[model samples]
Target chain A: MGDVTVTKSPDGVWCLCRLVRERLKAEVEEMKSQFSGFRPGLVVLQVGDRDDSNLYISSKLKAAAEIGIDAKHLRLPNTTTQDEVLQSILSVNQNLSVHGLIVQLPLDSVSSIDTELITNAVCPEKDVDGLSCMNAGKLSRGDLSDCFIPCTPNGCMELIRQTGVSVAGKHAVVIGRSKIVGAPMHDLLLWNHATVTTCHSKTLDLPEQVGRADVLVVGAGRAEMVRGEWLKEGAVVIDCGINHIPDETKLSGKRVVGDVHYASANQRAGFITPVPGGVGPMTVAMLMESALRVTLCSLTGGRRHGNSSGVVNRK
Target chain B: MGDVTVTKSPDGVWCLCRLVRERLKAEVEEMKSQFSGFRPGLVVLQVGDRDDSNLYISSKLKAAAEIGIDAKHLRLPNTTTQDEVLQSILSVNQNLSVHGLIVQLPLDSVSSIDTELITNAVCPEKDVDGLSCMNAGKLSRGDLSDCFIPCTPNGCMELIRQTGVSVAGKHAVVIGRSKIVGAPMHDLLLWNHATVTTCHSKTLDLPEQVGRADVLVVGAGRAEMVRGEWLKEGAVVIDCGINHIPDETKLSGKRVVGDVHYASANQRAGFITPVPGGVGPMTVAMLMESALRVTLCSLTGGRRHGNSSGVVNRK
Candidate 1:
């Protein structure tokens, strides 16, 4: 009998945090030396003080600080009115020092403040979150120049590109279709020349579809919903889902998990990302990159004015 | 052996032209009775004398006239300057009588006029082509309530929905990725909850991918590229391709064909759209529909004045 090759052992998830951190730190130091009083300024607007929102804001601020970017957190009470949020966004938009502005999502869904209206109010130039219709439209049309890509999907793309697998002609299956992650990921993969398939909660044959992927990106936000057995051999798996489940073993009585079953997926998959350290750090890194881009555009007067060529002119 | 049941013959392409035409005519007659001077006025701007563009404009005008809509063909010389085209568009945009304006595509590509710039110059309200960033972005974000969906893809969707197949949970494979048909088709299908896979020139295993689809939409514009043998059993095929090939047998010395091999695909497919009679008529019909929508919006004072609530909140 031909010797059975042992299944390749679990390769450690690519440690992007250190690499991105060092690069950002270097960029910041160089900028400081070249241009005095030049620091990228980012503001995070939060309302209702959700616990998870607080955690996300703190991590973002820490990442910004590490890279020498000035970060501010603007908090609003649960009772904040729509006008109040819009007024704050307008003021921040006018602030020349604020290079990037992000309104933290899930802003009290029960409240009268329309999320879409508030997000659109942010100056497109400073819309670091890239949720505004203008940026989303530009991204959908495959125009990346001078556009801020949403951080999570952008980070996921960076991770997939780092795998050294050419995206062109590859079958990439994305699970989930949220505006932020899944939809943008679909566009990004399509733009990179991948035969992309998007499977959501409505997908009938999830296993069969997932099994067909050369590169599988799961962002369904369900903890460990994707099993390892369904993965194609040598598939590159990117888990964008960050879910927390109760765990008696931890002091906090909870542990973070991704959409994929990491332990099992690691065995069969050629490349897989672990939940906590994989996509989380990369999201922060991409945000820093967005901030830097916005800052540079502001400095160089590359800020797009009204009714210009919105399509990215591909040379 | 039990009777093969003949694998159900290919159903005739849903004749959306007749349906849309009849409905539009009814609406126009009703409007004539209800309000005087309420005819929907559409202006077609042709920058060059392209034969195909001429044919398209004539059909559009014929359709508009049949429905009591005022249609004007504004022919610009091939030597028309960019400013002249822009000036014409601006005048048409300001003309209160004109509800919709479309600049025929491939308008003197040799000229200094940038197609993107020219198209973007049209007021989004009058952009019946729906190629503007505003409409494309709104469509991408799944906000279809107030957006003018690009005609061809909208027609394709209308045909598919007429097939009585629920798009949700279907594995829809779209061949082609052009901004006009394929890209928008992908978004429309995705919005309808289909697990959509976009296959283009970069697709390596076209046969395998096509075989996996329960619903296949082909718009590669190549003459009969997809064969029946490659299709999944009982798959519904929507061919958006319109390609011409020389045939000595015809007096015109040419015949029109689709991206799919009709003879072979019709044998195995449960539903198949014929080339000349399929998506082409639907495209014209949808264009008329777009004009009517814009006109009604204008008459009812639904004209969006500002950036407030871009999402079309249908009453």
Candidate 2:
């Protein structure tokens, strides 16, 4: 057998992340000249900060800073009411300076908050997180050029593009149906002309289903639930899952793993993403890309130049 | 081999149609008693009379009359401008008397009209046709209760329910990706807990795809494309295509057929919908159902009680 290719090395992810950020930085500098010191702005709204949420938000903030975006962290008290959370979002929605808004999920609140309602409160135009129904709807209906796609799936597409395997006429199996990942990924792939099958928790014979995939994307949230033996040899496998498994050797006594067993899966897969270095950095990178696009569109007073095929063609 | 049971016999459709109409008639009569002669109203806006459109409109009008719905045929001239069409829909959207509205497609206008733009203008509230991006988006995101599902797929689900085969966990294969049929059908089945695979023109190995389905839905618009040999034994086949083929014996020198080769498919399929009396009649029946639902929801001053599971559980 030929040597197996790891889809993304730690260095490779850092390189790609650096590439996207540097490009954005250059663009931001160019915009400063064209628009009289105009800066693209983003707001990350968080409530009742869960530790994991804080960590994720911090990563996003760090990325935004690196890319020269005017980023703000709008942290609310843990006891913030739903209406109060909504008011915060609405204020950002009306803020002409802020071009992008993302609500940090799993709101840590003493009061019962409706996550869907809160997510939908962000205006579709500024919804860089792409969780709002309006944006999700636009994405689902093959209006890829017109809506903001969720970050993970968008990043996964970018990774798949790097593999140089044409998505058209390929069999794409998406493992999960979460609004954020699996569902939109299926739409993106289908519009790209792949025959897409979505398999979830209830899917009987998961291995059998995964075997037919030329491209398999797993966001099932289960830790290494998909075995290497289930993969079709030489398939392009993208693991979106970030599960924590205990390991006595580690200082934290736990190690991060993806939805697929990386060690075994790499033996069979033509390409596979490592849990830490693969989709994680790319997700943050895509968020920056989206934030930049939103900023540009707002500044230009026009819509995002949507690609009809739903695939990012940017070199 | 097991007996090949036809999904919808002409008599069965007639019976089902009558049952629904009679129930609707009773409901209308009850509403008359409560609201003092408030008849459920529907407006069918037709632009440029294609004969097929006319025939479909006539059937809708007939069905509405039987159900005591005050159905109006709003016919516009072939030379009508797109602006005029939009104005017509906008006026209907504001009219309190009208609860449901459908624009007959293939706008036979002399001037080029943006169909998607016009379809979106119908106001999601009155869009009984469910072609609007808003409704399509809601349906795509598994928000089945909050959206009007396109009638054909809605009716297909009703037929599938009638078959007593559980959709959940089943491998459902849908051919085609048109917004109205295949795409929506995929969403509907996926939400119903089925493992759905959507195949279109770009799909490789169509037969292999078909062979794996526990439930097969074909709406490729190509006549007799799916042969019996491709089907898994006892597969429940739902054919949504209506293509006219040469039949010299007929007075019109043509006959209607489905995407599946019915005669041959019956040999392998445990349950299969016939061409003329199958999905065709059910589509009309579903349109009537949707119109009635919109009217009832309007009168109730509350949202229609949406079934989260998305299957029509009405006996």
Candidate 3:
């Protein structure tokens, strides 16, 4: 077993993340004592049998249990109706007990899903994932200091903070521009002081842009796509990709690798998040954090955790 | 007066500005056929004597008259009520005759303006200037295929298309991420296929980021802020800055210049929007285009002008 490299970053801001976590622990403890009636619950609906989705769900359930959130997992048949899926979401959306609802994606390619309708149907308050059309608008407008940001990207941010990298004034390169990861990631980085360039399949020169970054995030799911040479010296890296590759050495049929070749990149990375232990862990943690925050706010008459510091705890 | 640089940009794209003049001409010729109709009414509300606001409103009114649109101006006292100002917007919103309404901003310092409420209350369909919150949300969601876009930025885009510069796969660096320009500009660029980098006061290294642009748009309104030396060779520059400096030689007592030090910038630039003949005129033309589009959409069941290749009169 290889222990990952976990060093203090030279160029980023780690103390900020500590401050945020301190505030989170403090706020959650305070809420537990005072929020007598508060019980934050999150319901996740996953369909079919994708190993990735199952892994994501289990981690979320475990995180929810560890934090004081109630996470319920419901698996539906791949042949479920769009109406049935929407009904399940609306049920959780309306259930006062469930503060948030996340409908897991990759619905069978055979059965078309109306993403817009599902997103629009999510109650804005319980949109802890913050993927709803209304919440997306709030983020884009840069007016939502109180809005629930989507988990994975926000998790990337929490990690960035932990690394002690000041995003504001840094050159952050994002590989991929999907609505969930790259697009929202760019906006969040821009909000935090990073000048961001997003690249995708059509990007003219991939390495040139990557060469200029002070911080790099790769969400493009091509295994080992970002080589060690593509990084800026001492640049902080957050790898969000999870690709399963055949490995003869693995106990399982195959092993998982990230978008970057870990060993070589870690040697050059000032701070980097290892695949399974890094962003994957932070995402579920953030979701639990979001659900708990939502519960506290609803209990306190639609107000927030009220930490003037703008940091709240998941646990 | 020194002869100004004029790049007569070719029109007819997703930008609504190009269709305004020809649409207006057609509407005027048909005015007699529908005298009972509202004569395409437009009302503009002004709060103060800010020179720039005066210039913009005057240009709009001049263009409205030339097009035979019912042009009406209401100058409210600097001490206008939030309700009173809102009432004007309300009346216009309710008025069957009025097809478009504009509430000029930066209300006099003597009277605090309720900009948000004003923006929130305006009808999205008639938000010709495109500052309404509703329109903003729609645009950010990539829903502008049916919404009114802010005009000056739209005009900036028309210039690019006129140059036959393909937006797809290009990089756009937008300086000054204000609600009116930067935010919408970012979304619009994405819609058109340009990877966008947005910068504000908090951004780390200004010139370093600016130096890597394929297209640079400066809307900070700071005179000569972007030096000629900062631009990438052969890059197109759109200087949205309109500043007044002491000019003893001019009768107006001051002279106008753009954010770019144009003479120096023009030397290295492949294309640029000059202080007078560039974005300024194109903005009014776009507003007229928006009004005409709004009218046609209303008459034809809220159908938008067709996507980039909108209804255009070649002659």
Candidate 4:
């Protein structure tokens, strides 16, 4: 029997992430020299200090520091009011020094603050997280260059690009519909010229759908829900799910896994991304890229202001 | 073999359109009684007088008049500049009497007027055509109740709803991605809980993809492109393409057709919409409905302004 060539792409992701950061660093340095020490700034707005949120924020800050970005952690008390949160966001929106803003979500708050209102309050030009309706609309309508795509999907696309698999005319089946991951991923893939299918909890015969994918991206929160048997032979799989399950083998008592069953999927897949070493690092990396892009556009006076472009250009 | 039921839906569309007009008439009368002879007004701005544009405007005007709406045809000269068109649109926007406004598309002008700019200049609150990015953004985010959906897709959804087929969990294959028809149709279906696959010219194995659809909506603008043999048995098909092909048998030397080959499609489809009489009439009806809805909301002070809702609620 001919040997199956299953390419595991953890190293590929690390290299890609490193290269992006390096390019961003070089660009940021050039901008600083040209604009008289104009340092690109990003503000991470957190409603509460949950340990997980803190961990995410710290990693973002670390990446920003490495890229020579002015990264600030705007942490609010858990007992903060909705108006107070909005006030803080509005203040950041007006801050000339801050070019990018992201609200660390699942707002751990005593009071029920509206997350949508808070995220949308971030100026669209400064919405590096790309969760605002304006950015989401632009992305949905295939206005990729003008809009900020959500970080995780952007990272997933970058990974898919690295696989050297041409997305055009290929069937890409996305097995989630979450705004941050599945939904945006579907849009990104479709705009990239892939025939895209979006499967969700309501989807029937999901395995059948998955089996037809030339490229498969899964962000369904359930750990190891997608099986190896369901995947098409030589399919490129990008798993975005980060689920922690009890593991006696690990000292931390739990280990992170993806939506796809890695060992089994690896046996049949042509290219597969491992959970911890794959999409997670790329998501953080894409966030830095988005921040850098937003800063460059806004500071360089190339920002588009209310210019209406028709979303339907494919016809 | 038993008889295959093929429900041709031209009658249903006519009935739906009439009922909607009746409902709108009654509502306008009620509003007039309450607010001192207040009448809902709609403004259709036409830049130039193309024969098709004139025909479309006349139909819309006729529908608006039937609904007791104060319909005005703001026809500008063919030599009108982009700035002049913008000025006209902005004037209509500021007019408190005008509750709904639509710019008749393909602005047949001597100057190369920006269609996107002209369409978007109509204030979102008064944008009955629903071509504005603000409305498009809201619709994409599944804010169905708040956003004005583009007329054609909204009409198609109504037709599908009339068929008594539950969209939720069904496999819907949309064969085009035009903003006015296919793209919005996909979004509407996705939000309504259908698993949607969007296929365009880039789609390989198109027939195989078509065979899997429980529900199929085609707006590819190609005359009789989708054959019946490719369809899933008893699929609900909505054809939005209006194309004219040469027919020697007809006196006009041309006949209208849809994207689907209707004669063959009728044999397999449980429900199918016919061209010229199906989606065409419904689009006009939906435009009138949208205008009425916008007027009711704006004049009654129920319109929402500048609310930032995140598009990703599916998680």
Candidate 3 docks at the CAPRI level of acceptable
Model 2: CAPRI class: medium
Q: Which number leads on DockQ? A: 2
Indicate the worst ten consecutive residues by lDDT in candidate 1 chain A.
A1-10
lDDT of 1 by residue, A204-297 (tens): 8999999989989999989999999999988888899889999999999999999999988987787777788787778888888878767766
| Shift of residue B257 alpha carbon in model 3, Å | 1.1
Among all candidates shown, the one with the greatest lDDT: 2
lDDT of 3 at A26: 60
Q: Candidate 4 on A1-315: residue-level lDDT in tens?
A: 022242475787677778878987897899899989999899998987888889889989998999899999999999999999989989999999999999998898999887777877888889888888778777787776667778888788877876778688999999888778888888888988899999999997899999999899999999999999999998899999889999999999999899999999988888889988788787888888778777777776775321111123311
Clashing pairs in 2: A48-A108, A145-A306
Give the alpha carbon lDDT tens digit for every residue of B254-288 in model 1. 99899999999988887778888888888888888
User: For residues B160-264, what per-residue lDDT tens digits would candidate 2 score against the true structure?
Assistant: 766778788999999998878988899999988999999999998999999999999999999999999999999989999989999999999999999999988
Put the candidates in TM-score order, highest first.
2, 4, 1, 3
> For candidate 2, what is the recovered fraction of reference interface contacts?
0.70
The sequence of per-residue lDDT tens digits that candidate 2 reaches over residues A202-268 is 8998999999999999999999999999999989889999899999999999999999999899888
Given candidate 4, what's the lDDT at residue B262? Answer: 97
TM-score top scorer: 2
Per-residue alpha-carbon lDDT of candidate 3 for residues A127-175, written as tens digits (9 for 90 to 100): 8877765566556666556567777888888777665566777788888
Model 2 quality (TM-score)? 0.95
* Model 2: residues with Cα > 4 Å off, grouped in runs: A1-10, A306-315, B1-10, B306-315
Mark the 10 consecutive residues where model 4 chain B has the least summed lDDT: B306-315
Ranking 1 against 2 by TM-score, winner: 2
lDDT of 4: 0.82
